[model samples]
Target: MKFLIFILGPSLLAIAVPLYNRIEPRLAGFPVFYWYLLLLIPFGSLCLYLYDRGRSDDRRPE
Candidate 1:
């Protein structure tokens, strides 16, 4: 369960950005979809990084 959640969390965000881009209308002369897609790149990276870090922290120290 933990592994699934860890993997799915970033995967969903990756999918959501493109999906949002396809669905959202343009705003302020910039596509909201593009904005979200761009934003999600770093955000997803951060999420993946944090998940991995947390998993590593859970290990019993040798």
Candidate 2:
């Protein structure tokens, strides 16, 4: 479950360049690549947060 969260960013980013390299779709006049990267910001943050949450739970107290 947690492992899936960690891979979210990598998986999406792996295809992001090819997927959003075009300029066919525009959002608010912004290019698809621009908005696509903007959208990934929050998504990547969420993935990192989830991974950190899961990693912290595995810590061993000294």
Candidate 3:
């Protein structure tokens, strides 16, 4: 359902953070752990924004 998108964003982070909990790979001297978390901010926001956008039409008055 539409609600899945709302749940998916944070759920992905919850699952991904631990799975990706490593310091091997680096980006611009930042460890994978640090950069990946930084990257997720926008990704998570986009997911939630998409979810809200998907629901906006439903709430609009005719």
Candidate 4:
């Protein structure tokens, strides 16, 4: 699960650069590259929250 976090967050963002490095199909008159980066903000936050939640669970006395 921890490994999945890295793959989803950073890896996904990295993948987007090449995949969305285009100018067609713009959103709100913004290029795909720009919109992708904007959307990544929330996606990255969710990933970080998931990671932090998992990490906290690990530290709890069991």
Off by over 4 Å in 2: 1-8, 11-15
Candidate 1: tens digits of C-alpha lDDT, residues 17-51: 44675634765656777776777778777777877
Model 1 spans with C-alpha error above 4 angstroms: 1-6, 17-19, 22-28, 60-62
Sorted by TM-score (best first), the order is 3, 4, 2, 1
The per-model lDDT (C-alpha) reads 0.71, 0.77, 0.77, 0.76
1-62: candidate 2 lDDT, tens digit per residue: 66765766557684768888978689999898888888887788788887878778778886
Looking at model 4, the pairs that clash are: none
Q: TM-score: which candidate is best? A: 3
Give the winner by lDDT: 1 or 4.
Answer: 4
For 1-62, candidate 3 gives per-residue lDDT tens digits of 66765757566676766767998888999988888888877777887888878878779775
Per-residue error for 58 in candidate 3, Å, reads 1.0
Alpha carbon lDDT at 23, candidate 4 = 88
In candidate 3, stretches whose alpha carbon ends up further than 4 angstroms from where it belongs are 60-62
Give all TM-scores, in the order shown. 0.59, 0.68, 0.72, 0.68
Q: Comparing 1 and 2 by TM-score, which wins?
A: 2
How do the candidates rank by lDDT, highest first? Answer: 2, 3, 4, 1
> Candidate 1 local accuracy as lDDT?
0.71
